[model samples]
Target chain A: MVFDKKKSPYLFLLPFLIMFFSFWLWPILQSLYWSMLEWDGLRAPTFVGFRNYIKLFSEQDYIIALSNTVSAAIVYIGIMVIVALFLGFMLNSSILPGRAAFRTIIFLPVTVSLPVIALVFFIIFAKNNGVLNNIISTLGFGRSIDWLGDPRINLWSIVSLRIWRASGFYAIFILAGLQSIPEEVIEASIIDGASGWKTIRLIVLPLLRPVIIYVIIASSIWAFQLFEEPWILTRGGPVNSTATIAMHVYRNGFQFFQLGYASASAYVLTAIIVVFALIQLLINKGK
Target chain B: MKKVLTAAAILLLSFGFLSASGAEESKAEGPIELSYWGWGPHVVGVNETISPAFKEMYPDVTVKAEALGPWDLMDKFYVSMVSGKGAPDAAQLVRRVSEKYLISELLYDFTGFMNEYDGQFSEALNRDVLSVDGKYLGIPLDYGPSALFYNKPLAEKLGIDVSTIVTWDDFYELAVKISREYPDLYIMTQYYPAGTWGSNYYRMFMQSAGANIYDAEGKVIRNNQKMVEVLEFLYKLHADVKTLNIPVNDPLMWEESRKNNILFYPRNSYFSGEMEQQVPEMDGVIHTIPWPLWSEDDDPQYTGNWGGVALVVPQKGPHADIAAEFCKFFATNVEALTQHWYTTTGVPSYAPARDNIIKDNTNETFAKGLMEAITVREVGPWYYTDWAQTEKILGDGLDNMFGGKLTPAEAWQWTEDQLIKILGR
Candidate 1:
């Protein structure tokens, strides 16, 4: 008679629901209202309904940030998926010894600090004297390439580092998925005269669908919040080439102290993220 | 079920009560546990800047300063200010949106407090804080008086008469020669995508032409000939004379330039610490000159007048009058001023403080020159500075021009287009 736990799990969820509503839901609702305003954080956010969003359409910097974010996302997700699958295959390979060590090495970047990773990459790709550039120069190359200078290529420099950082983490997830695959099914595939590639393509790849979706969802969410690297490395510049929306939002809020404008931008960015999540959910559902 | 609900309600209410009680306790008199948040070499770890002196003076008002990474600090400040949580009373707000706060009714006005304590500090009070409407929201923290830091060794090595480098063209020639001579050595570190543009160039050129982003009224003025000249001049050095690949994000760029094969770096006031560190073996290897004179003025002078940090009393605090008095005390006290200057490697706002700081200053040869540079600096402190926007014009513009993406005029036009978009005028 007393609140039936089985009949109403919503009752059990009520506390979490309240906490979520108070913090996340309320801020998100507030931000949507702000997106329509003209604010500079410190001052009263004037209600310039839809002007901020209107401006966002034509703004070159925002466009650049948006594109760069897409580029980072593609590179980040692509690396995660590709590396995760490859490492999974390696982990599944019985002939390849030291699976545990390989898994540990691939998974280590996730545990390490990103700034430290960035610092290491910063030294490696430095124009005047990066380890990688030094090696390139030593190989009888004429010029020391400015890795993060060229506007078109600077985004790649960031993406490569991002790939290096994220692939290992995704590999762990893929490895877990590979482990979940029952031995009997794989043995049956092997006896059916399927080669390693065929077995992977038909048996392992098809079965790891849920894990793949999880990896995509998790990484996409992480990719949306690509602030620390862009903040640390180029700061969305050589001229707004690397400027992500998150970094821009951060700048408006903090550096510029145009909180109202920043909040509006934040909400716009949040909406964009929500759209991305929704699209991801739709895709997962279709799958 | 009833018992469980009662327990849950009690816990929630008690936690809320505890939080409110903590806020009350923070405001209480007995050993005031106040926390000041800022960004620098972690304030708590490195107890040099905000010292034990303040703690000693007000033993009851215990202050623990913490450093949040500068950008992160700004983000937290923004969030806290809006949400009304975890904001420090006297947090250092950057001077970017000091305008919006002035025009709009946001910050706690500090005019009444300033008038009351006119005796303690001198006339070095930065009037730049007050908007056109005359509401002083922010106290000047640090001034960026642009100066030309020339490596004496590098200049001597290049065999260029450093004194003859009077104009932007002349500096360019000297820089090119030094760069050509020492192929490995860049003439200077001209960073893009950061404090690269709209700074030394912007101030110097703007002052040179007597035109700025605003003209008395806080209106956006984009098309200034001088502003264009600033971009064009930077484009020349950036295109023809190759500078180092340095992104001016960290303060350490100055240090890197000095250590590497660089001749002159045009920055403001803070390069003294860098020079001191770079050429520690050679006691007097560096000299500070006025920013390389850019324009053809009747009586040419360099501009570096980025007014340094100022003290302010927050709106609501216990003993607000006493807090104002503390600011005045610290601002005036020669000993305190000297400590601030020495510890922060920041310039003293007070002219009197200059004498004490320079007397026993164990910095590089630039110490004497720096004080003189500050004295002679033509400050053009503007309120509404879109630093990111202008840097796009100068930094990214220069880079593209170098890579042959756009011609100088085309780059300028593109920049103008971008600025129009940013400033919306």
Candidate 2:
């Protein structure tokens, strides 16, 4: 059944429009509406304008979750970017042997299931008979510290796992960026008697700025959305020290059924991510 | 064309009549399918055994049990309830998660069905726990009463009289003594504070001591003197006495504790299954006793619950009456509960079944202890609404106190402050 040429485009687009409205756009608007109300997912929502948003900022739990997420972003991104870049820099070098094998090894973690990774790390980080603790004990480290039990250290342990899981994927991206850099430029720099460090600092890094920005943007978003690692490993505990904003939203929404407040917190988290992304854009513009 | 149309219409009418006759036939004699959602092998085993028995009793009804983890079941339950679609006819609901669903009016009230077994349950659950307004919401399936499970061999070697410790203070002294004599073998693992504030241990201890986070009227009472006292007691155990080991539910910790021959592990009846299953070597070596009291002067209500589930029929499901029938069959039938006790490890809440199991297994220390302990099992007001947040607050304070970051007073104060702020009290 053919439509007239002008109407055909609209006809072709109708299914997508219907889906967009029903699934995506409607939920976004509904969640925004929900953010202003007081709802336990079970009962009908009560209108309480701005109260949820106010409570989110005022509550200590929300603040702690936010700060933990920010800390994770800083710690995870810093280690991940530096390590991925170094690996990329090495793997891209003509002098390196078995580059493909190294690349595969680096990217392997990305392929493993996140929950499985969390479980494996949970075993490794176990205070007794754990692979890490055993190794540390053999090296004459005193009694095994309760790595997951101690609130002060558990978040860092979770961060380390996140770094381990993510660094490989980011390395491949950077490797691609490194490969795209012109060979002639590196040779020219060498001919000018520039030191290896100088060549990397000035030429290689400058050329890889866009890729670095991309990594930072993607990773920071991923970092802020952290739930599974901490949830499976710690359940956001040893206290809520390891809890992220995502975990808090999950607790409020699912466990407690305070969906309205959860929606408010979620929007605040989205705002934080957007602001960070915008800052990244500014940095990209400056570069 | 007229002849052909008449023949087609006659054929369609005949088919319709046959379909109508088939429906009538099935109405007289056909199997009724009922869907049940539950978690774990215990539920599966019970359903598997009970289904055949149930079918034998009522040959027309079929019970289909879908075993899933609690979280998975909750996800499906919530989505189905909200959407008014895809709900199973029956499901197991934990007391911890009952309020949210009950408040939504999603559950079919089982009051009438429950009335049939008025005197059957071993202990009558507070009606308010399974009720919203005046309507009973679900049937209590199991009881979770906290108890001290100890290693008999280790206790014997240490010269500790396990039965003599009747109070927390007495238990504390025993812990100190064990820690002093056997530094290698920790007496107990207090992993509660590690999970979250208002952790299971804290909740259980507080409830056992007759102090809950909220009063009957639903006012925040977490900052009371009783809570402060309990927190101080836990802190002293962890920080000063240094008798409490930190396991925090880790598999490695369990392994290490087993290797070190931990003398005591405080847990509910439900956890005994795990202890026995995961570390089968401790079968004859382990013994359980009723939880110690807060003080000798205080009353001897020495138990509090950690986990208990109820059988609830969803309002929007295929067969509510059949589901209720199955629930009654599962909950009150002596044969079913007896089979359940033998096959799996839930302490049946039905009096006849529970009493029979207890009488038959009087020699089993674990069963005896569980029977003695679960009598005080009750659901408090704090079980519902913002309890998770309270748990988080309690968790942080408990962790800080245990980790040497805060004193007991400070921890209590911190938790109180958070609760006051969050609860808007």
Candidate 3:
């Protein structure tokens, strides 16, 4: 081999490029190829053109999965952002004693394993002898509501868990944003006879937009890919009310063994994620 | 530094080339090593006993057994099978999830091997599960025939002769009587809307009623009159009578329910061992019985099956012969079956082995009851193929009915439409 010292830097990049192509780039390309086939994962992948995509679009379960995911992302993102901001502000506020302790308490959920947390919540939300249901029954409700069993309430149950688990992590970022705000700016607002709420509305809120946007984007992405919590808690049941699109992907790929169809669903999910992310970016740009 | 770097580059290139060529060396075998994949702790323990026994029969063929959870096994199978790499020579596939892979035709047909056994295997599995168009796809390892496990103490306390409750209606009457006496107690903790309830018990009830959610051809038959009648019957029993209690899936809660509250649980015989393991307090109190019928007149004497695993050889693997022999040995040989049974808590799929077991151990009423129910009826061919999908649809309907979102009639409609949409009817 001809050696050139100047080109050796490019040689240094070769290993990384090879790994990237082998692992990441190759799989994406392979996925695209598999998406157009009729494969059950074991047999030779038969070319089906666009039929898998067409079939996916027509499936009610897919629609349910998508709608459930989208609704969850919207609701969870909205609530998470607000709660995160409040906690962030509280943790960042100089007047609040034991702010570190409060931050630690809030962050505890984010640090705990998702499946473990889900198991704990599954117990707390069981129809009979559950912590919450027992409390409800003791408070004069004749019968305990099946928190995880009732379709109407189950999605909200998952949403509550998502919010509880996510708020702390989001708040940490928001807290960073809170800290970054110039102390002089708040002092000036207070000197101008602005009330605490008014100052927060005018100053903190405006300055925290970028971090809030980041939080929203990250949280929405997490919400869209919600799997373990609902999977462990309900297995996407009480009907398909809690079945997220990712769960559908998993069910198709693993359970049903429809790899081609699953790949199509996956690409569509990727497109959805891209579109949502782009929308967030466009909104941020517009602002 | 440059000399060292140049040497390193050459060494790396040589290593890659060596590895690429080293793949061919796998063919250079003195002893055939067959890789057998299975799941759960039982897989390892069972294989530990079976491997040596298998080697004793065929000393030249070495067995390499591995275990993973059911889902993980599927995952590994997918990764290996799809890429045409790392495929196990044989695997213990969960029968419920095995049908989808049959379409791939990747499994080595065991019809010849099964014929070699010639009536040694369980008759019901030979007819229903393993056979596809006169070809056997795999050899059955074991089966989980559904049976009713009741708390004898609870039944005695209530003066309920559970054995006399031949029909489901009679069982419901027993439930009502018990509930009248003890308002807090329920017949069982049914996992509703979803869970094993839809997968196991509902299917058992439907089969006992001479109707299944899907026909043999994988067509939706949920709207069949028998199916509708059964749904209505269960609806009334669950909704009106309110016999089910504690709709939860937690092990702790399950332990509590089995120990204290629930009276009658219709589960598979596979759970008989686990019952004692899970709640040791209920060890002597629990007894197994044949699943109650919808009516005395219900014919074909059919029943439902729960979880089971089967051994299959992958066609793409190098050692099909050794894998097939291993599968045959495990499926047919009395020694291997007995070892598998004792080690893994598995009931042998081989009739002779099963007979030997039942004959030798007459005291385990659960196993004896399971043996009697085993040859009766297995799941329809389409059951495992579309299991997850069917479960979701039927599960939703069940949820709707029990959650008070829809009446049984409306839930039936929902299930039918959903199945139609999903199954492309």
Candidate order by DockQ, highest to lowest? Answer: 1, 3, 2
Residues B279-347 of candidate 3 have per-residue lDDT tens digits of: 655556777677777668766556667657788888767887778888887777776676555444467
RMSD of model 2 against the true structure? 7.4
Q: Interface RMSD values for the candidates, listed in order?
A: 4.4, 8.2, 4.1
lDDT of each: 0.63, 0.74, 0.74
lDDT of 1 by residue, B1-425 (tens): 97578656755775576467646224555655455565543254224434456666766754556767554665676566555555665555444433333533345566655555444333433454433354555545444566777768767766767778667788887777766767777677665534323343444444543446554443556566665666667667776776765555333354355465566777666556544544455446667766656665735354644334444444554444444444555555567666655444566555567667667766533333666655564555443355544544445555556557877667666666666666664
- The true-versus-predicted C-alpha distance at residue B233 of model 3, in Å, is 2.0
Report the C-alpha lDDT of model 1 over A12-93, residue by residue, as the tens digit: 6666765776577767777787777766554556788777777776767677777788778878787768877887777767
TM-score of the candidate numbered 1?
Answer: 0.84
Top candidate (TM-score): 3
* Model 2, span B1-425: residue lDDT tens: 87557545655565566456544122223668777888765666656788888888789888889888777788788767765667788888666556656652578877776676777764335342676676778888876667777777777877778889888898888788767866666667666453431276667777677776666566676548887888888777776454434434545445655675577877777666666556666667767787888877765455666657788888656577778778888988887876665544567777788888767765453333555555543432234445555666777777778777888888888888877876775
Candidate 2 docks with a DockQ of 0.24
Model 1: chain A TM-score against the true structure: 0.90
For all the predictions, what are the DockQ values?
0.37, 0.24, 0.36
Off by over 4 Å in 3: A1-6, A94-98, A182-185, A191-193, B1-25, B31-34, B58-64, B103-105, B193-197, B213-223, B241-249, B298-300, B342-345, B362-388, B400-425
Per-residue lDDT for A1-287 in model 3, tens only?
87898768767876775566656886899999989998887766799999999988787778988899998888999899999998998898889999889889999998998757876886788666778988988898878887877777899998999899989989999999989999999999999999999999999999998998888877777888888877777778867788889998888887777889999999988888889888988998898
